[model samples]
Target: MKTLTRKEFIEQVGIGAAVLFVAACAGSCKKTAQGPSSVNFTIDVSTGNLATNGGFLVQNGVVVARTSSGSFIAVAATCTHQGGTLNYSSGSNQFVCPLHGAIFSSTGAAVSGPTSTAVQKYNTTLTGNSLRVYS
Candidate 1:
């Protein structure tokens, strides 16, 4: 077997590394091309005086309040299966996506769906009357 020179071996390795890095970077960058980078926005519900089982969508994001229990939960309004916009529906105690009728409960549980994946949920904490959600 012919062994490669040290310089030749290093050159091949470097080229392979560069190719792998570029491939990895390309995959990560593809999602950004569709639009502006994914963004996170905050909702201020401290003053809403919401009733039991009340909920609202903030800047297209959904937050459900278990008013009788004074607890709140935040979930991404985007559907995981098809990326459709989801809305909180009081009639069903769940989030409903209009495009494909995907349903998720307030805790981001998949209630029913054309989808098997549930909505992405945020960490919510009640500081006084304010509900804060984070990654």
Candidate 2:
């Protein structure tokens, strides 16, 4: 058996801590929607869940929501706090993550939740039956 000197012990501990930190950060290093790079898609609002207010659907990594007042808003579908899937709350006009109760505003700004990072927001334009979501 061998006993480590103070210097050796400190070096080993430091290395171990560095390894742990890297490992911990590796998960966060994954790509976030981060306003996505470029988003341009068309959704049919004449029918389906989008036809009425208080309805939402996820498309191309973005969640398209219709507010209670019949307004359209689009944001990243993933929660910034822990990458959980987000759901639209028409009553609160917010996005919520079921996994950790993280909340985000309709504009994708994290608020009163575990995360402070805001998700991506997309511009939307409605032309009759077609709703175009773009960056």
Residue-wise C-alpha lDDT for candidate 1, range 1-135, written one tens digit per residue: 889999999999999999999998986743211111343444466555343455565454544444334566667767766878777776556778789888888777777878766666666766665566665
Off by over 4 Å in 1: 1-42, 48-53, 60-69
lDDT of each: 0.64, 0.90
Runs off by more than 4 Å, candidate 2: 1-33
C-alpha-based local distance difference test score of model 2: 0.90
Q: Pairing residues by index, what is the TM-score of model 2?
A: 0.74
Model 2 residue pairs with clashes: none
- Tens digits of per-residue lDDT, candidate 2, 88-129, equal 999999999999998889888888788878899899999988
Task: Name the top lDDT candidate.
Answer: 2
Candidate 2, poorest ten consecutive residues by summed lDDT: 29-38
Quote model 1's TM-score: 0.56
